[model samples]
Target: MDGISDVAVGVKRGSDQLSTYKNTISGTDCMNDGASNGSDSKKLKVDAAPPSRVLHIRKVPSEVSDAELIALGLPFGKVTNILTLKGKNQAFLEMGTEEAAITMVNYYNSVPPSVRNMPIFIQYSNHKELKTDSSNQQTRAVLPAVSTVPSLSSDNQEAAGTSPVLRIVIDNLFYPVTLDVLQQIFSKFGTVMKIITFTKNNQFQALLQYSEPAHAQQAKQALDCQNIYNSCCTLHIDFSKLVNLNVKYNNDKSRDYTRPELPTGDGQHSLDSAVAAALRKDSSLLGALNPLSAAAVVAAGKVALAGQPGVLLVSNLNEEMVTPQSLFTFFGVYGDVQRVKILYNKKDSALVQMSDCNQAQLAMSHLNGQKMYGNVIRVTLSKHQTVALPRDGLDVQGLTKDYANSPLHRFKKPGSKNFQNIFPPSATLHLSNIPQNVTEDDLQLLFTNTGGTVKAFKFFQDHKMALIQMSTVEEAIQALIDLHNYSMGGNQHLRVSFSKSSI
Candidate 1:
């Protein structure tokens, strides 16, 4: 252990001060020459060797346990053997295959492995494998039992890269997908042990772990490239690199079912609160299948709409053209509009109420930055619990209106199909419920009359449904506001909403 002196002295000065920590310590002969040449000679040896099954790890803290070192290699592949040089503060790990070793090295090269918050170095070892006598007590102690290590067999790994965990990416996510939704969907196949949801590369992604690898494989096979709802919220699933997930909190973003007593963490609401609220309200807003029970829908709503209010404060409107009914119709594209109150003095501003917080959140997410009546509108959660009506005898240009019992509420019915087709506003609009007699030219003329350009149009195989692309999103918004529930001949009202697909 020639380099032992440098590392031992560096350890005293703290890991931050170790500038030569990146050097790879090879065999006995190199370690013998390492003290004199320092990092320069070791750096040459580091690049001289090609990929191998054994990886040489440097700057391993003496206090770090064998299990910690093994855990580092577990994510990449199986760790067959390990040999720790306590005096040199280094170790050599033997992966099950050379490919696994190369993957580990490449990954660590960018992310850089750390144990106990201390940075460590990993590179391919010159030796292909570690040779240790099976009779040696130390060697026996270092080898982990196959049962304890959750490594996939080579056959299973080659077949589908099977693991106990799945990585899920949600595409075209118009409606919020909560952790409870994921648990309910995956638990139908097996026991969902844990889940972690995050946003990466501008996409909503999740890591879910099942109690068994077979469960994960089944769920992946069934769910990959499938839509969570009728046509949107597509799920792209694959086997996660991780064999298991480490969930620290039982909150909306992450959960550990085995450890239910864990804290919800800061700024997070407990599942109990979400479930209690969901039970008291309608559960149709969550369109995902609930194999667990109605309670899962409640939990999904609570987590998805946590901290959101049922009322929205809208501002910067076109005062001359904006109206209570117009605001109700526009916002109703995303939720059931309950009430609307246009500020009498500030005509450009208004307060809109939805059936519940989930609806309000959905509306805000979609229409906050959207254009309305030739002006960009701003939508935010209102501090007021309810929009107060004007005095009984007094009327301010009839600005406020109550739609609590209005038949136009799209999400009023439980498990409404309307919940499944929600999408963010786009230039293309999905038009449905068209009168059979209404021709494409008639619809095009109607939308064009709204002072917007009609880019393209295509009727579905069933002429009752069609896609219309406008010159811009603003023009489409204007068309939707003007024509959503417009009366067609024979009492049929046209239905309009944003479409995820282009014509």
Candidate 2:
């Protein structure tokens, strides 16, 4: 330990100060060498053991742990001990034998190892064995190296390469693949830093960033040409020229896994208020709070809309059930539907282009995550401003040729009254003031004749309120206008508005 001194002295300090400490220890060693008497005890034989089976790592992240270091080395061979110089962001990892150390060094020396995206330089340590002192032992949390950090090395170390970002394109998009779905898929290789989903050339495209390029390469190789669900969402992968992805919004399309949020349906309530509401009412009330009508919620959500494009990314359809006409039948309710293109490479997904962003936003906020055809669909503002149909090939045949002036469009239809009293459209409509004995079929019949097509109908547990998912935003708005304050039965005045939940 001649060149090393006071490993514990600067454990809580930074790297620059630790360098100065090392210089001081070097000066002390030189002085001791000059002052030493010619004693036989000080002399050692030349045939001492070679360097120990330890690898020295430098430039590590300060937050990285002993367990993480063990995880890194465990793939090559058994790890014997770990010494962490916390403040300096360095460590010495001792493997079970010198051969193990050589294997680790030769492999990672040409390509460096990384933890948390920070590249770490590795070399052989001179020590024959790590010293286990009480102070150092007390400071570290040691675990057997047999276990692995699933996030770090689910694949071989060779796949944990140097680049950190990957660009992924869905060749065939049939499933409703959300940012959450991509995160779940790519995270097995390494820590996923960020993911951004958008539509390019009418296809679902995404950018995924891992902590290291090797992880990205591994994920790309494993998932390329793989289907997300039942051979529909085929993945096409490549290395991004950019080293990292910049994510500014935590919206439907972009997610940074370094900072993750709660699931999709759980955003309506705060922690304290949710508990309070649960205590006040039955636990069922804790599911999703609906204080305002769906129209009001849609109106509120519009203020945050980027107003970027008419294109909408639709997800979560049953590939077995969703078709170009089915998408048109639903999205056409909100605005003049221009075109519908079912992505050939993805399962249960399609692109619906409206005449304007207003209609797209109206449709997105209302119908997102609403049940249709036995599956809940998720809709979001696509990064593409419009759906550009392929100029050549059979894909163009999937486009809706005459959607602009189609009779199916609510406003363009003959004698359509929706133009005068247009509320912000939503798919889920809230209906209150219902008679206790009234059934779902009765309410469905009332709306189907005037409001629009009914996709789903469900009464609240109390039977006084219900949520109805109309086929389109216009229908929900028409129903809201027609039914608000209308008589139901026996002094009951019906109150209807757009609902927040599509169920």
Candidate 3:
């Protein structure tokens, strides 16, 4: 009876051990399943936040402006309104539609927010839309942008009814499309008879009369939907009902092509007394305004300050990309480039002397801190009055006729075979048929300033041929696209192509 009791106790102990082992396996499985579900729940939290149209972007770089914010949204969709608190490092952007906002949020959230080298964070705002002051908005009703070419469309029979009188409405008003700019662009189509600029419904509208209706049509067809320079000044042109544009007055708002008083922007122009007085008054009031108003005034002040003349020191340049002529081309856009001296002591730096301090200031304000040839161009006033030219290297003095003549004018005389001619981008660009006067630095300057990083440069035994190595295949392609058939001095058109062997 005692032996039977011992066997029964041992069996009871074995049963308890089996139970404990089963419990341990069950707890471990529960933990493994919980961990997987936890990860899924986190991902759901990110994806399931109810899609919102309005995004409240936080942690924005303080230096970021409203324009930069608008630019960020441009890739996704049209941005209706942008409010930036530079001091607070936050911004609110209103997209054209809800879908656009959602798309932008989804894409950016998955990635990271970065602008101007500053990391940013974007999230949905509690408010569906941003509230803006009606008084603050520059409510202008400009002409609507024509999406399709109605004039050239087959369905429209009136396409042939060209009119010499063209009513030009600038599609984009954010750009400072001035009277002189219109005259220069329209002049290519035909002799612009006269121009009158007026603000209608808060939009910039202009009346341009050409010598012939055919010329007006040609200009409209060519320039319509095309940006003037960079990307801002888009032209939306149409034929006017009137046969001729009347020029009743000669003032800031109107300019007759026949009038000699109109400035050609050749560094000889000055603001009238009335405009000057208004600017001075506004400058005095800069301290009292809010953050938004202050930012606008500051930008205006920069342009106004650019009118001052002095020597501008440009640094942080890719030595392969910078050249005296390229510097002349860029700075000349703002003011007259009197002289350009690439520093021999510092090959990566240079000094550009503008005609006056105003021009120097303007160049510095616009071109300073801008990316050129994979580097931010550092523009500042030089302590020395002028840059001393090196005896050995090339120095550009006075304005090149191409630059002094017009703003961003390339490929002069339309319909030249050069218009259709194109050279694909490559890593190593082969250059031939170069002019004797054009130095290696000149060629390098042309490529780098126009979005290229020169990795290597070589001239063959034949001085006319040279090989330029860009930092990447894409940069080489851009150089080839921009410089092919480019007139270097003495009627020499640049011959550019890709080299099979990497230099």
The C-alpha stretches of model 2 lying farther than 4 A from their native spots are 1-307, 391-393, 396-402, 412-503
Go through the candidates in order and give each one's C-alpha lDDT: 0.68, 0.57, 0.53
lDDT for predicted candidate 2 compared with the true structure: 0.57
Best by TM-score: 1
- Candidate 3, superposed: residue stretches over 4 Å from native: 1-49, 133-225, 228-503
Error of 1 at 153 (Å): 8.8
**Clashes in candidate 1: how many?**
0
Model 2 agreement with the true structure over 1-503: per-residue lDDT tens digits: 11011111222232332333332222211222211332223322223234568776666677765545555564355555566665445677777778767766765755467665556666666566654444334322232212122344555455445457666766433224566456545644555677766643334567778777776775666555555544344566766555666555556666554443324322221123332332234211112112131111111112123234788999887888666766775666566788887777786788889878767865774467566665667787776767776766656546434366664465565344443223334678777779988888888998888737999888889999899988876566556555656678898877665444557
Q: Name the candidate, 1 or 3, with the larger lDDT value.
A: 1
Structural similarity to truth (TM-score) of each candidate = 0.48, 0.31, 0.29
Q: Give the TM-score of candidate 2.
A: 0.31
Query: In candidate 3, what are the lDDT values of residues 1-503, reduced to their tens digit?
Result: 11111222332342333332222222211222212222323221333335566666656666554444544454354455445444345566666667768767866765566665455666665556554334423311110111111234443336536457666655433224555456544554445667766543323467777766666776666655555433333455666656655555554456664543444342222334443343234211111112121111112112223223378888997888676676765565455666677766677888888766655654664455555567766787776676554454343432212233443333344543323222222478778888877788988898998676888889888779899999876576457656766888677787776564456
